[model samples]
Target: MNWRFNICFISFMFLFLLGLSNVFLGIYFCLNNIIYFLEWEIVTLNSMNIIMTLLFDWMSLIFMGFVLFISSMVILYSHNYMEGDVNLVRFILLVLMFVLSMMLLIISPNMISILLGWDGLGLISYLLVIYYQNFKSYSAGMLTVLSNRLGDVAFLLSIAWMLNYGSWNYVFFINFMGNTMESQIIAFLMIFAAMTKSAQIPFSSWLPAAMAAPTPVSALVHSSTLVTAGVYLMIRFNVLIMSTDLSKYLLLVGGMTMFMSGVGANFEYDLKKIIALSTLSQLGLMMSILSMGLPNLAFFHLLTHALFKALLFMCAGVIIHNMLDCQDIRYMGGLVHQLPLTASFFNTSNLALCGFPFLAGFYSKDLILEMCLVSNLNFVSFLFYFVSTGFTACYTARLIYYTMSGDLNMVSCSSVTDESWFMLKGMMGMLFMAVVGGSMLSWVLFPSPLMVCLPFELKTLALSVSVLGAAIGYSMAHTNYNDSLLSMHNILISFFLGSMWFMPYISTRGVYIYPMKIGTNLLKSFDQGWCEGMGGQGMYEALKNFSKTNQSYQNNFLKIYLTFFVLWIILMLLIF
Candidate 1:
C-alpha cells in the first residue's frame, strides 16, 4: 500500500510535467496566435479516407494544461481522502484514465477521432461514478451513463451528416457553414450533444445525481472534465452555431437551467449536492452566454470555474471526512473555530465561486455580466442573467453561514480536526490558481482590451445583484424562520423549492416511467408470448410430431413394404 501511494505520487508528478509542457505550448500559441494542424492518414480505401487530426490552438493548449493540472491536484487530494481503502491504486488509475479521455477529446479535430475521446469520456465517467459499488452509486452511474449515451449518439449522427463534405475535420468547414441548411442540421445535432455533456435544462438531472461518486471524482468530473466537454465543443463550433435559431433555443434552455439550479441550491441541505447544484447553475450561465455569441467568455469562465469548484469540492471532502461522512449542512456549524485552515480554503473558494472582486471568478464573471448587459437581449433573458447571478451569491452565502459561521452543532466537536495534510496539500496546490486564475486567463486569452461604453446604472447592475444576494442569503440563514409567520404559511412553497423544482421526480419518473413500462410490455408480449410461442414452442412441437410419425412408420416398415409389392405385381399383370 505504501508503494502504491508512491506510485500515485509519481503519476501525479508526471502529469504535472505534462501540464507544464502544455502551458508552454499554450503560451507559444497565444504569443503567435498560431494554429498547428497535424494530420496523419490512417486508412485510404477508394474515395473514403480516415485520418487522425489534431488541432492545436490557444484554446486546446490552455484547456489541456488546465485539465492536466487539476487532475494532478485531484489525485494528490485523493491520497488522504481515499486512505485505508484497498482500491486506492485503482482509483488513481481511473482518475488518470479520465484525464486521458479529456485530453483526447480536447486535441481531436476530426469527428471520428472526437468520438473515440467522447466515448472514452462517457465510459470512464461511468466507471468513476460507480466506483463505490453501492446501490446509490450504481443508480447514479446508470443515470449518468444513459444521459451521456444520448450525446454519443448525437455525435455519431453529426459525423454521418458531415460525411457529405467528404471530411470529418470540422475545422475545415467552420467558415464554409454560414447560411447553409446542411450545416445547421449538423450544428443542431452537435448542440444537443453539447447540452447533454454540459447538463443543460432537460438533461441536467444526472449532474446532481453524480454526487454519489467520491468527492474527488465530483471535483474532477463535474467541475473540470466531463461537464465542460460540451462547452468546449460548442466553443469550437461557435462559427456554425452562433446567431442561429438553435442558439436562441440554447439561450432559453441555459437560462432556465441556471435559474432553476440556483433556486434549487438555496433550498438544498446536502453539502455536496449544494455544490453540485451550483456547478449546474454556473454551467447554465456559461451555456447562456455562449448562446449570446461570446464563446471566449464562456471558455474563460469554464477555466476559472474549474479551479474554484475543484477547490471547493476538496474543502467539502475534508469536512465530510472529519464529520464521519455526514453530508447534511444542518449537522455542521462553527467549523472555523475547529478547522481554521480548511475553513479558510472553503470560504475562499466559495467567495471565488460567488465572483468576489479581484479573485479568479470575478475576472470572467464580471465580463460575462457586462457583456450580457450590453448585448441586445430581451427582458426575460436580462432577468434570467441578473437574477441567476444574485441567486449564486445567495446560495453560497447560505452555505458558508450554515457550515462555518453558526454555533458548534456536532456532538463531538473536538473530533473534527483537519490533521490530514495530504488533503490540505491538494487544496494548497490549487489555492493560488483559485485566487488568480480569472485574472491570468483574462489577460492572456484576451490581450486586447474589451471596449464597452455603458450607462452608470448598467455598469453597477452586477454589483447590485451580488450585494443584494449576499444580504438576502445572510438574512435567510441567520434569522429564525421557524418562529416567523411566513415559515408556516409557506410550507408548501418551501417544499417545492427544497425539492429542486421536482427535477428528480420529473427526470426519473416523469420521463422514464412510461417508456420503461412500455418496454416491459413489449418484452412480455412480443418476446415472450408471440416470438417464443410462434418461433420457439411452435417449431419444437412440429419437429416432435414429425419425429414421432417417422419412428412409428419405421417400426411397421417390413409389413407395409410386403403389401405394397404384392399390389404392384397384380396391377402390372392386369395391364399386360
Candidate 2:
C-alpha cells in the first residue's frame, strides 16, 4: 500500500482534519458561551433513567482537539518508526482505538458511559504497553493495566454509589447533592480512581514501567491521554472536590508525588524514564492545584504540559531511533553536533519543562508557583512545592548535559543523524505548539490574567531554586558516575531515590510476595496436606480399608457363619 492510502496515513489525515475543526468549534463555543448536553435516554423505569450522554462544552471540545491533534502526529511518527515491522497496520488500528477511548472519556458526563470509556482506556493501554511482546513489556503492561484497573474498580463503585442518587449524569447531581454523604463517598472513590489512573504516590511505579511500549505510544499515552484522564475527571468534579474533605488527602499525596518523582528523575539515567518521571511530577502538580480549588489553573497546566511533553517524547524517539535502540543517556554524548534539529527540539522541550520564560510550560508552571506562594499552604507543602521545582530543573539540566555536550560515548562507526524525514515532520507540528501553545492556551483558558502580588524574595524563590538546581546538575554532569558512590549506604540512597523510593517494589513484589506465599502455603497445608488427607485422599483410604474387611468376610463367609451357628447351638444345649 502507498503512503497516502495506507492506514497510518489515512488515520493521521482524518484525525488532523477533525482536530482542526474541533479546535475551531471549541473556540466558537467558548466565545459564545454555549454548552451542549446531548443525551439519549436509553431506558426509563420508574425513577430510573439510563442515559447515554455526550457533553460538548468548551472543555471537552478543546481537550478532544488536543488529543486528536497529538494522536495524529504520533501516528505519523509511528508511520516511520514502525516501518519495517510486519504488523504495522495493527499498530495503527490500536492507536486509533486508544484515541477513540480518550474521546469517549472526554465527552461523557454519565457515570455509565464514563465507566465504558474508563475501562476502554485501561484495557487498551494494556494492549498498547505490551505491544513489543516481550517479558519486560509483559511485566510493564501488567503493572500498567492493573494499576489502571484500580481506577476502573473505583469508577464502577462510584457508579454504584451514585445509583442511589437516581441518575448517572453526575453533572446535574454534583451541584444539587455535592455535600451529601453519598456524594462524598462517590467523590472519594472518584479521587481514588483518579489517583490510580494518574499514578499518584503508591500507584506511580506503573508510569515508568509503561515505558515498555513503543515511542509513539509513549508520546501519546504519557503526554496527552491516559495519564491525564484522572486530572480531567477531577476537573469535571472540581466543585465536589473543593467542597469535600478529601481535598486534604489530595494535597498531601500530590505534594509527595511531585517531590518523589522529581528526585527520582534526577537520579535516573534512562531517557524515557526521566521524561516519565517528569510527567509524574506534572501530574502531581495538577492534582495539587486542583486540590487548591484552582481546577482552571490545573487544566491550564495540563494542556500546556501536553504540548511540550509530546514534543519531548518525539525528540527522545528520534534520538533513540538513531541510537539503534540504546535508551541510556550515559551512553550518549555530543548528539547536538550530530543531530542539530533533533537536539534543538530536545533542548526547546527541555527548557520548556524547566519553565523557561515565554515557553509553553512557563505560563502554567509560573502561575502554579505563584499560587502556591500566595496560598495559605502549610510549611511542609510550601517546602515541597519549591524543592520539587529545583529538582525539576536539576534533572532537566543533567539530562541536557549528558545528552548534548559530553564526549562521544557511542561506537566509532555508528550513525547518529536525524535522517528520517517523516519523524521530523511528525515533530514539526508539536514543536510549533511547544513554542506558542502556552501563551495561546493561557489567554484562552484565563480570559483575564491572574494577579499575583508578592515580595521580592518570595517572587524570586522559584528562579533561585531552579538556578541552584542547574548549577548542581551541571557540576554533577562532569563528575564520573562511579565517583558518587562513597559508600554502600549512599548507593542504597541513590537506588531508592532513583527507583522512586522503591515504590515499584511496593507495587509489584511487595504487593504480591506475601499474598503469593500465603497462597502457596494454603495450598500445601490444606489443598495438598491436611485437607487432602481428610477430604479426597482420606476418603479414598477409608473406602479401601472398608472394602478389604468386606472382601475378607466374603471369602470366609460359609465357614464364619457355620462356626457362629455351632457356638450358638452349643450354648443353647448347655442352657437346656
Candidate 3:
C-alpha cells in the first residue's frame, strides 16, 4: 500500500484511542460533574463540558466500543483482503476516513457535530462503494448515496426544528421533548430518518443493490456502520420517543418491517444479499423493542448483530473468492470436507445468527421477544414478533444449508483454501465471541429479576423453539421444497414495490391519482411556464447558442467586459 494509506490508517488508529479515552473519561466526568455545557457557545470552553460528557452513558459507551472494535477488525481484514488490488491504498484511506467519521458520530455532543459526522460517514461510504468502478458497483453506490441523502435531509430538518424550539444540546433536547407535542413530531421525523438509513420497508431496496460493493465494504458498512446509523439515532433519542405519542407507532412500523424483510430474504439467491436483508429484519426487531422502552435490549442486539453479521459477510467473501466470483448459493454445495475451517466458522456464525441456545443472537433476540410479550403494546405486536422469528429461522437455515450441506455436484476440489491469516483470525475471533459472549453479556446487562420476567420459565425454551424452526427450515432446504409458501403475500409485495418506485411522485403529488396528476401538472407548469419563462430558458438557450452565435465573441473583449461588469456590481453590493 501507498504511504498515504499508511499515514491515514495510523492516524485513524490514533484517533480511535483518543475517542476511547474520551468515553472512559466522559463517564468519570459525568459521575463527578466536573464540567457541563448549559447552552450553545460562540467558542467551545476549555473546561467546556468534558468531551466524555457527550457520550457518558452505557449505551454510548457500548456503541463506541463496538465501532472501535469492528473498525479495527475491518482495517486488519482489508490489509490481506485487498492485497494486490489497484485501489488498495485508496480503499484503506477511505476505510480510515469512514472509521474516524463513525467515531465522531458516536461521541458528537450537539446536533451539528452529530450531523457533520453523519454526513461525513455517508460521503466516505459512497466513495468506498464505488472504489472498484464497475458499472453495477457505480450504480449501486449512486443509489445508496441518494437514499442516504434523503435520510440526511430529514435529520437536518429535525435538527432545525429542535434548535428553533429552544433545545440546542442533547440534555436540553431530551428535557424539552418531554414537555410538548412538538416532541411527538420530532420523534416521528427522527424515526423517518432512521427508517431510511436503516433500510426499513419502503426504503430497503438500496441495501440489496449495495451488494455491488466489495465484501469487506459490505461487511463494514452494511453489517456494522451504515445501516446501524438509524438504530443509533433511535437509541440516542430514546428518552424522547419513550415519553411521546409517537412511541406508539414504533411497534407498528418496526414489526411490519421485520416481517416484510424476513420474507424477502427467502427470495434472494446471492449469499450476501440474503444476509443483508436479514440484517435489516433483525434491526427492525431491535427498533420494535426500543419503541417499547427497551433501549437496553436494542443496544445488546446491535452488538451481537455486528459481530455475527460481519463474520457471515466475511465468510461469504472467502467463499466467493474460492468459487471464482460465483455468489449464488445454489451453485455451492458440499464444501464441508474441503473447507473445514471455513465451514466451521461459517456454521458457527450462522448458528449464532439463527439464535441457537447460548449463542449471541439467542441472548439478544430473546430479550427483544420478552420485551414484546410484556410491553403494553397490543396483541398484534406480539403476533408480528412470533411470525418474524419463524421467518428469521427459515431464511437463516436456508443460508446454512444451501451453502454447506447439500450434494457435491458443483463442489470444486482444486484445493482452494480459506482466506489469509488476518481474515481467518478476524472471523474466528468473532465466532468465538458470538458463541460465548451472549451469556456473559446477558448476565451483565440483565440481572436475575429481569430474566425472570421473561415469558419462558427456562431460557432454554426459547432456544428450543428457535432450534425447531431451524430444523424445519433445514428440512425444507434439503428436500428442495419450494419456498413459495413463505413468500410475501403477492398483493402486499406488489403494493410495497410499487409504492417504493413512486414514493418521490407520491410525496410531491398526493397519493390519490387524480390529485397526483393535478399536482404534477402544476409543478410542470411552474417549472416550464413560470420559472423558465422568467429567465431559465433564456439562460439555457444563451449557453447553448453561445458557441454558434459568437465563436469569437465568447472568447472576446465584449463578453469579458460584460461578465466583469456583472461581477463588479455584485461585489460592490456585497461590500456596501
Find the candidate with the highest TM-score and give its number: 2
lDDT by residue (1-576, candidate 1, tens digit) is 779789779988998889879977897899798998997888999998677888889889989999999988888888889987898989888888889889989999888888888999999889988988999999889888988899899999999988888888888877787767788889899999999998987888899899988999999986779999999999999878983578899999999998999998888889999999999999999989988888888989999999999999999999999888899998898899999999999999998988899999999898999998778999999999999999999989889888988687777645888899878998998899999888888888888989778899988888889989988987887774324644346888877876777777787787677789989999999998889889988899899999997887788787787887999999999999
Q: With candidate 3 superimposed using the best TM-score fit, by how many Å does residue 190's alpha carbon deviate from the native? A: 1.1
Q: How do the candidates rank by TM-score, highest first?
A: 2, 1, 3
Best by lDDT: 2
Score candidate 2 by lDDT: 0.90
Give residue 135's lDDT in candidate 1 (0 to 100): 96
lDDT per model, in order? Answer: 0.88, 0.90, 0.73
* Cα misplacement distance, residue 488 of candidate 2 (Å): 7.3
Model 2: runs farther than 4 Å from truth? 1-5, 42-50, 480-489, 548-552, 555-576
> Using lDDT as the measure, what is the rank order of every candidate, best first?
2, 1, 3
TM-score of 1: 0.92
How close is every model to the real structure, measured as TM-score?
Answer: 0.92, 0.94, 0.79
* Predicted structure 3: lDDT: 0.73
> lDDT tens digits, residues 338-418, model 3?
678888888888888877767888888876666566667677887688777877788788877887775554556554676
